[model samples]
Target: MGFDFLEWLNLAARWLHLITGIAWIGSSFYFVWLDNNLERPGSDAEAAGVSGQLWSVHGGGFYHNQKYPVGPGQLPRNLHWFKYEAYFTWLSGFSLLVLVYYVGARSFLIDPAKAALEVDDATALGITSLIVSWLFYHNACRLLARWPLALGIVWFGYLVGAAAFLESVFASRGAYLHVGAIIGTAMVGNVFFVIIPNQRKVVAAIKAGEAVDPKLGAQGKQRSVHNNYMTLPVLLIMISHHYPMTYGAQRPWLVLALLGATGIAIRHIFNVRHRNGPTGRWIALAVVLALVSVTYVSMEKSGAPAAQASVDPDAISFADVQPIIEQHCTSCHAEQPTSELFSEPPLGLKLENFEEVHAASTKVKQMAVDSDAMPLGNMTGMTDEERATLGAWIDAGDPE
Candidate 1:
C-alpha cells in the first residue's frame, strides 16, 4: 500500500490532535486563573452557597463568574463539559502514534544499537509501558495524597527513571515519544477516571438533593493540580521528537530530566504569578539559566571528541566517503529516495553528488558522527565504523 494515503490520514489526525489539545489547555489555564483570582463573595452570594466570585472583561464585555464548593443550590439549565477536547486529543494522538511508529515500527521504533527488539516486541512494550505507567501514577497519587512534597519527588523521580528505561529500549525519537505517550496517557486517565467521575458524582448528588461528598471534590481538585503541573513538561516531551539534540544525546535520559525540570520550573513561575506570588521572577530567571545549561550540556555530550585524530584533507577524497553515504544515507537523502516513505529528499536535503554532500557536511557529521540519529532507526545498516569514517571525512574538509 502507498504511504501517501497513510501520510494524509496521519496529517489529519495530528491536526485534530493539536486543535483539541489547544482547546483543552486553554480551558485548563482559564479555570486555574479563575480559581486563583476569585474573591470571597459577599453576604448575599455566601447565603446562596457561592464560595467565590470573579469579575473580568473579555471581547469588549464585562463578565462575572461564581464558584460553589458543592452546587449553586441547583444545577444550571445548560452545562458545558470540557471533556471531549481531552478525550479527542488523546484519541487522535494515540492514532497518530500507531500510524507513524507502530505501523512503521522498523523504521521509527527500534534501534538495534539501543536494543535488539523485534517489531512485535517493541509494539507490546510501548502499549504495556503506557498502561503500567498510568497504573503506577494513579496509585502513587493515592498513596502520597497527604504529602505533596513526597508525591512530587516520586513523580519527578519516576520520569527520570522512565526516561532512562525508554532510552535503553528504543531509538532516540521512539524513546522520547514513548515517554510523552505515557505522560499523555496519565493526563487523559486523570480526566477520565478521576476528574470527570468525581464531577459527575457531585452533579448527581446535587440533583438528588443529598449531601455531596467533599472528598470527591477534593480528589478532583488534586488531579487537576497534577494535570496543571504536568502541562509544561508534557509539552516539552511532545515537541522533543523534532529536535535531535534532545533525543539524540549520549545520555538522553539526563537531557530529558534537565529539560523537564526547566519546563516545570517555568511552569511554577507562571502558576505563582497567577496567584500574585513574589517568587515567580526568581523562578523564571532560574529557568532561563537552566535552559542555557541544558543547551551547553547537550552539545558537549552529543559531540564527544573522537578518539582518533582528524584525517588529513589532502589525503582524503570524496570516493572514500561516497560509498558510505550512498550505501546508508542517500536512500532517504537523495533527489529520489529509494524508500517508499519519501517523495523527495527529507528536509529538502539531497546528497546525490559530491557538491551536495560537501554543502551539507556539517549536518551529515551531526547526524552520523555526533549521533546515530540518521538512517532512521539505522534501517540502512549503517555501521559505527562507517559513521566514524564519515566524521573523519567531514573533519578533513570534504576533499574532492
Candidate 2:
C-alpha cells in the first residue's frame, strides 16, 4: 500500500510516450494516405491554388479535403500545428529511457559478459549514439538529396552498424532499445529541425503575400515520407524486450537488421496499396524476410546441442530445475522479489514453487532456454548447463 514513486513515474512516462507516439504516427500516416489518395482538383479549385482534392464519407458524415501543392492563397486564421505530438512523444520516450535504463543501468543496461562499463560510461555512450545517429542521418539526407535510393541504402547500413556497436557494448535488450531510441531521436529531429521550420517559413511567406518556395515543401514531404516508413520498425523495437528471441539471438545485430528490413517491406506494402499500386511483390518480400528471421532465431545456437543432448528429458524433472530457478530466476520472479531491481515479480510471474514454474514452462523455455535472455544481464551468472536442464524439464512435460 506504500507509494512506489519511481514505478509510478515509469508508468506515467511510458503511457504518455505511447499516447503521443500514436498521435504523431497516426497523423503522419493519415497525411501520407491523404497525399496518395488525392485526385486532381477541379478547374475552379485549381485556379484558387488547390492542387488536389479527395472526398470521403466516415462516421455518418462526408468530408472533403484539398491539398495545395505549396500554400493556400491566404493563410488560415486557425492553423493547427502537428509538431507538439512529435515533440512530446520524444520527450516522454526519453524520460522513460532515463528512468528504466539509465537509472537502473547495472540491472538493465550493462552486461558484464559484453563489456565492463561504469554506469556513467554506459549512459554517456547511449546518449552519444542518439546524437551521432541523428547527425549522420541528417547529413546523409542532405548530401544525397537528389539520390534517395543511395541515401536509404547508406542510412540503413549506418543503422546496422550502430546496432552492431551497441550490441557489443550493452546488454542485448539494452542494445535493442538503444537502436530504437536512435531511430526515435532521428524521427523527432526531422520534425523539430526540418519539417516544422520549413512549414513555419511557408506560413510566414503566405502571411506576407510572398511566393512560397516549393523546395521547402518538397523537403518537408521527403522527411515526412521517411518518418512514415520508419514507424513500423520503431514499433517493433519498442516491444522487442518482451520477446528475447529477437535480441537474444546469437547475432542480435543481424537479427535486428533482418527484422528491420521485414518491417520496412511491410510498410512499403501499405504505402503501395495507399497509392493504388501493385503490392504483390512487397507482400512476398515481407513474408519471406519474416520467415527467415523467425527461422534464424529458432535455429539452435552453435554449442547448444551439446549441452541440450547431455540432459536427458526422460531423466530430468521439475526438481532438477527447482534449484536453478530459485538461484537465478526467483530473485526477480517471486511474490516478494529479493532483487532491488523489482518491488514485485516481473510480469507477475512467480516461480517459487513447482506448479508456478510448470505453468510458465513455455516462457521459461523461451527466455532462459531458447535464448539466454533471462537472469537479466546474466546478473546471477546462470550457466549453459542450468538452461539446458530447464529445457530438458520442459521437454519432459514438467515432470514432478
Candidate 3:
C-alpha cells in the first residue's frame, strides 16, 4: 500500500511518459493533416513533385507547409528536432512495463494456460518483441520503400503473423499490449535512428549549399508515414486492457485484428484527404461498422462456457447465488457499500437488498461470470467458491 522508492520513481516517470507521448503523436498527426490540406504555392519550383501541401494559422500566427517527395531546397539554422518526445515516451513506457506487467505477471501479463513461460520468459518475450519489431519494420521499409505495393503487402503479412503470435504465446491481454508496445518502440526508433540521422545528412548538405540527396529524405518520409499510420492503433491497444472483452475474449486476437484494421482504414481516409484527393469517408465508416460487428462476435462467444460443467439450479440459486452477491458483489455494487474499496456503486447498479439484487440480476451475471471486475479480484481477494457461486447464478436462469 505504501510507496517504495522504485514505485515513486515509476509514478513520476509515468507522468512524463503521457505528456511527451501526447506531444509527439499530436504533432505528427497534425502535420499529416496539414500536408494534406495545404495549397500549392506560387513560383514553387523547389516544391514541385510534393506528396501534399497545406497552410495553417495557430496561436495568432500563420504558416505555410509543403511536403517535398524530393528533399527540401534549403535547411534553416537552429531547426528544432521533434525526436525527444518519441524517445522519452518509449523510455518511460518501458519503465512502466517493468513496474506493472513484469512485476505482476500472474495478474497482468501471464496466462499459464497459454504458455509454460515463467515470469522471466514472459518478460524476455515482451522486451525482445519490442526490439525485433522495429528491426522487422525498418528492414521491411528499407527493402520496399520504392515499391509501395510491396511494402503494403509485407506490412499486412507482418500484422497477420503478429495476430497469430498473440494467440500462441501470451494471454490475449499480454499479447495485444505487447504488440502495441512493439509498434510504439518502432515509432520511437524511427525518430532515434532512421529519420533523425537522415534529416541530419540532408540538413548538412543543404547548409553547405549542396543539393540534398533525395533518397535520404524519401527513406525518412517513409518511416515517418508508417509511424503516422500506426499511432491510432497503438493508442487504442495501450488502453484496451481496462476493457474486459477487448483483450480478454476467447478469440481476442480476432478483436485485435479488427482494431488494427480500423485504425489503418481510418488513417487511409486521412491520407486520401491529405493528397488533395476525394475523401474516403466510406472506407472509414466501413471500418468502424466492421469493428462493431467484430465486437459483437466476441460478445456472443463470451456467453459460452469458459468452464467445463454447468451448475445445478436449486442448489446454486437458493443457497449460493444470493449470498455471494451480498458478500462480494454488494460491497462495490450497493448504494452505501460497506466495502472500503469503492465509495460509489459502479455502473449505478445496486445490489443492497433482494429486490435490487434481482433487478440487477442480468448485470451481475455478466460482470461476475463474463468479466473479472466484480469483486476487484486483481486488487483484492475473491475466494474460488465465491466466484463459483456467481458463475452458477449466471449458468442457472434467474428465478425468484
Candidate 4:
C-alpha cells in the first residue's frame, strides 16, 4: 500500500485529539461527581477549613477527599494543573480541521447544491464562524452570569440556529463538523480565557495571604459546569462524520438539536446520580424517547418508499453499473486511488469490480442513494438518474 503524507498527518492529529479529550473529560467528570457526593465536614474538619469531604474505597484501598470552600490556610506542596489536556485537545482538533476541511475545501467543505461558494470563501466562513461563536459565548457568560439555566437554553438555541445557517452554506458533512468544532473551541476558550485565569487569581490571592475574591472562584466554577454539560454533545459531534443520517437529513439542524438535547439530558442524569437525585430515571427515559423520535424521523425522511419502482435484478448486470462506479467512486474507493489525498481505497472498500459492488450494496445505498453523502462533495457529479438506478439495483437484492 502507498502512503499519503496528509492522511498520516491526520491520523497523528486525531490520535492526540482523542487522547487529550479523554483526559480532559475524565477529570471534569470526576470533579463533578466528587462535588455532588461530598458530605458536610465534622466539627474538627470544619475548624481546619474543610467544608465538605468524601470517603470511598477503590482498588482495595480507602480514599478520603476534602474540599475547602475557599483556599486552605496554606497551599499544598504539589499541585497538578488540568489545563494542558484542554489546550492540547483543542490544538490537535483544530489541526485536524484545517488539514481535512480547509486544505480540501473543494471536495470536503463546499456543497454547490447548498451554496455557490469558492473554496476560499467556504474556508473563510468556517473559520469566521468559530471565532464569532466564541465571542458570543464569552459575552453571554458574562452578561447572563446570574442565570445559568437561562443562559444554557439561549446558547442551545444559538447552536441550533447556527446549524441551520451552516447547513445552508456548507456541505452537510462540513456543516455538522463545523458545529462540533465551534463547541470544542468554546470549551477550550473557557479554560484558557476564563477558567484558568480566574483560578490563577484565586490561587495568587491565597498564596499572598490575602482573602481570595469569591467571585473569581465562582466564575471559574460556572464555566467548569458548562464544560461538563457540553462534553457529551461535543463527543457526538466529533464522531458525526461517520454517520450520514445525522448530518444528511433535510433538516439536519433539527436533527442536531434533538440529538444534542438527548446528550445533555443523559449527562444530567449522570451528574445527579451519585446524589440520589430523583430525576435520573426521568432523564434516561427522555433520552430513549428522543433517540426513538430522531431515528423514526430520519428513516421516514430518507429511506426509500416501499412503492419505489422495482427492477429485475437479473437485467441489472455488473456491466451496466461499472461505468458509473468508475466515474464517481473509484477515485477514492479503488485499490490504488488516483486521488492524491488517499493512499489507498477509503475504508478498504475497492469498487473496481462487480463483486466489490455487490459486497458494498448496503453502504452504497446508505451513503450514495439515500443520503447523497458519497462522492465526497459530489466531486464526480453523479447524476440523479445514476442514483435512481443504483437504488433500484440495491432494492432488488443486488442479483449477480
Candidate 5:
C-alpha cells in the first residue's frame, strides 16, 4: 500500500496528463470545426484566397475570425503560440508511459512465453521503436507528401507492419501498449521539432516586419493535422491496459488496427461536423459501428481470439501460489485476514482456494503489477522474492 517517490510522481504525471490532454484535444477539435464552418465573405480581402469568416460570442464578447489560404502577410507581433498544449500534454503522457509501462515493465510489458527476453530488452525495443517510428514518419511525411495520397498508403503499410511485428514477438497486451507509445512520441516530437521551429521563424519574420513565408505555416499545419488524427487512438492506447477485455484478447493487434482506423475516421466526422451537421454525425456513427463489428466478428474466431487465453482452472494451481498468497496476501485477502484486522476480503477478493486464485489472475497481475496493495500492511513482510513468485506465476501462462 505504501508508495515510493517515483510511484507518487507517476500518479501526479497521470493527473496532469489527463487535464492537459482534454484542453489540447478540445482546442484541436474545436479549431478543425471552426475552420470548416467559417463563411466566405466576398470582399476585397476575399481576393487573397480567404475562404471563410465567422462571428462568435463567448465570455460576453463578440469575436470575428477569418481564414486565409496561407499567410495573409507578415505574422502578428502579438502571436500566441498554440504549441504548449501539444508539448505539455505529450510531456506528462510520456512521463506516465515511462513510469507505468517502462519502469514497471517486468510486471507490465514482458511476456516470457511470447518473447524470451529480459525486461531491459523489452524496454529498449519499445523505446527504439518509438523513436524510430517518429523519424520514419517525419521523413516520409516530408518526402512523399507531394504524392497526395502517399501518407495514407505509407501509414496503412506501417500500421500493418507494426501489428504483424507486435503479434509475432509479444503478447497482445505488449503490442497494443507500444502502439500508443509510438504515437505519443511522435506527437511530442512534432512540437519540439517541426511546430515550434516553424513558429519561431514566423515570429522572427513578424518582428523584423518582413514577409512571412506561407510554406512554413503550411508545414506546421500539416503536422498538427497528423497529431489531430492520432489523438483518439492514442487515448485508447493509454487506457487499454486497464481493460483486460480489449488487450488480453487474441489477435489484439488486429483489434488495435481497427480501433485506430475508427479513431481516424471518427475524427473526419467531427472535422466536417460544423459544415455538414447531422450528415457528419452519420459518418462518425457508421465508423463506430464498423469498429464494433470488427471486434464482434473477431470474437467468433473459434475460441482462440486474444482474450480467451484460457481460463483453464487447472492451469494456475492453488498450491504454488496459495501458500505464497496466504503468507503475504491472505492477511488482508482472507475472509478475515488476521494480519489486517479486516472482516472481509479487501476488495471482496477471496484468494482462499484454487478457484478464487485462477478467477482473479488478472486482478492479481494488476495488483502485483504496481504493488498497489497486497500482504495488507506488509504484515507478513512480503519480500520482493514473494512478489516475483506471484508475478511470474501469472506471467508463466498462469499454469496450475
Candidate 6:
C-alpha cells in the first residue's frame, strides 16, 4: 500500500496537540489547587520569605510544597518552568488548525450558505481572528487591571460577539473551533508574555539581593487564575465537532455562549470549593445554565423542521430517498468513499445500502435533516428540500 503523508502528518500533529494540551492544563489545574489549599507558613518559614505551604502524600511518599509571595530569599540553582507546555501545545494545535481547516478550506471551513468566501479569504480571516482576539484580550486586561469584575464581563461579552460573527462567516464547526483557538491563544499569551516575564524579573531581583515587586506576583497570579477558569470551556470546544447537536443548532452562536457560560460557572464552583468557600449558590447556578443550554439546542427551528408536515409519511420510502443519498451523501459515506477527504467512511459509517442507512437513520436525521452539519461544508450542495425529504423518510420509519 502507498503512504498517506497528509493523513499521517495530521495524526502526528493531533497527537502532539493532545499530549501537550494535557500537560499544560494539568499544571494549570494543579497550581491553582495547590495555591488555594496552601496553609499559612509558620513564623520561622514566614521570616525566611515563605508565604504558604502544603503537605500531601502520594505514591507512598510525602511531599511538601512552598510558595513565596514574591521571590525566595535566594534563587534556586535549578528552577523549573511551565512555559514550554503552553508553547508547544499552541504550536501543535495551530498546526492542526492549518492542516485540517485552512488547507481543506473548501471542504471544512467555507459554508456558501453562510458566506461565499474563497479559500484564501477564509484562511486569512481565520489567522486574522486569532491575532485580533489576542490583542483585544490583552489590551482589555491592561485597561481594566484594577477592576477585575468589569474586565471579566467585558471579556465574556467579546467572546459571545466573536461567536456570532464567526458563525456568520465560516462553517459552524469552523466557527466553533476558531473560538476555541482564540481563547487558547490568549491563555498561552498569558504564560509567555505576562507570567514568565514577571517570574524572570523577580528571579533577577532576588539574585541581585534587591527587593521584589509585589505587583509582579499579583499580575502573574491573576493571569494564572484566568487560565484555570478558561480550561473547561476550551476543552469542550476541542471535542465539540464530534457532536453536531452543539454546532448544528439553529443559533449555534447562542448555543456556544450558553454552553461556554455553563463551563465557566462549573469551573468557578471547583475554584470556590478548593478555597473552602460555600459552593451551594455557584453549584445551583451551574446546573441552571447547563439545563438552559440543553433545552435551547434541542428546540426545533423554523427553517430546519424535524419533519416535513406536508409530506405523507406513507408515500415516502427507502426507494424515494435512495437517490437523494446517492447524490449528496454516498460520496463520503459509502464503503469505498470517492471523496478525496477520506480514505474510509467517516466515523466508520457506510450508508450505501438500505440496512446501513436504516441503522444510521437517527444520525442522518440529525446531521442532514435537522441541521446542515453533514456533507462537510455542504460540498455536494445538499438542498433544504432534499433534507426535508430525508427527514420525512426517517419519520415514516424509513420504510423499504
- TM-score, each model? 0.92, 0.97, 0.78, 0.94, 0.74, 0.96
Better-scoring candidate (lDDT), 1 or 5: 1
> How would you encode candidate 5's per-residue C-alpha lDDT over 1-400 as one tens digit per residue?
3335774687799889888888888887777768777887777769865778888999999998887655556554565667777788878877876786677665456555567767778778887888888888888888977763678668656865886686566545667767787887777787779878987887777667787888887887787777788888889888876665556445567667777777777776776566766655658675676668465545644454222222243454446667787776666677765642444565588887777877898788765532423432233555655665676667776666
Judge candidate 4 at residue 342 and give its lDDT.
82
Tell how far residue 63 is off in model 3, in angstroms. Answer: 2.7
Ranking by lDDT: 2, 6, 4, 1, 3, 5
Report the Cα lDDT for residue 390, model 4. 81
Encode model 2's per-residue lDDT on 46-118: one tens digit a residue.
9999989999999999999999879898877898889999999999999989999999999899999889999
> Which 10-residue window of candidate 5 scores lowest in summed lDDT?
305-314
Ranking by TM-score: 2, 6, 4, 1, 3, 5
lDDT of 5: 0.70
What is the C-alpha local distance difference test score of each model? Answer: 0.84, 0.91, 0.71, 0.86, 0.70, 0.91
Off by over 4 Å in 4: 302-314
Candidate 2 vs. true structure, TM-score? 0.97
Per-residue alpha-carbon lDDT of candidate 6 for residues 1-400, written as tens digits (9 for 90 to 100): 3577988999999999999999999999999999999999899999998989999999999999999999788778899989999999999999999999999999999998889899999999999999999999999999999999899899989999999999999999999999999999999999999999999999889988998999999999999988988888899999999888899887888988988988999999989999999999999999999999887766546444454534566797888899999999999998788999888788899899899999999999888887889989988888787888888889888899
On residues 1-400, what C-alpha lDDT tens digit does candidate 1 reach at each position?
Answer: 3357876898899999999999988998888888888899999999999889999998999999999987767899998888899999999999988998899889999888778889999999999999989999999999999998899889889988988998888887888888888888988999999999999999999899999888998898888878887888889888876667778777888888877777777777777887888975768676785877577776776568654423454576888888888898888887778887776787899998999999999888877777778889988887777777787788777778
Worst 10 residues of 1 by lDDT: 305-314
Stretches of candidate 2 exceeding 4 Å from the true structure: 300-305, 308-313
Q: Candidate 1, clashing residue pairs?
A: none
- Provide backbone clash counts, one per model: 0, 0, 3, 0, 10, 0
TM-score of 4: 0.94
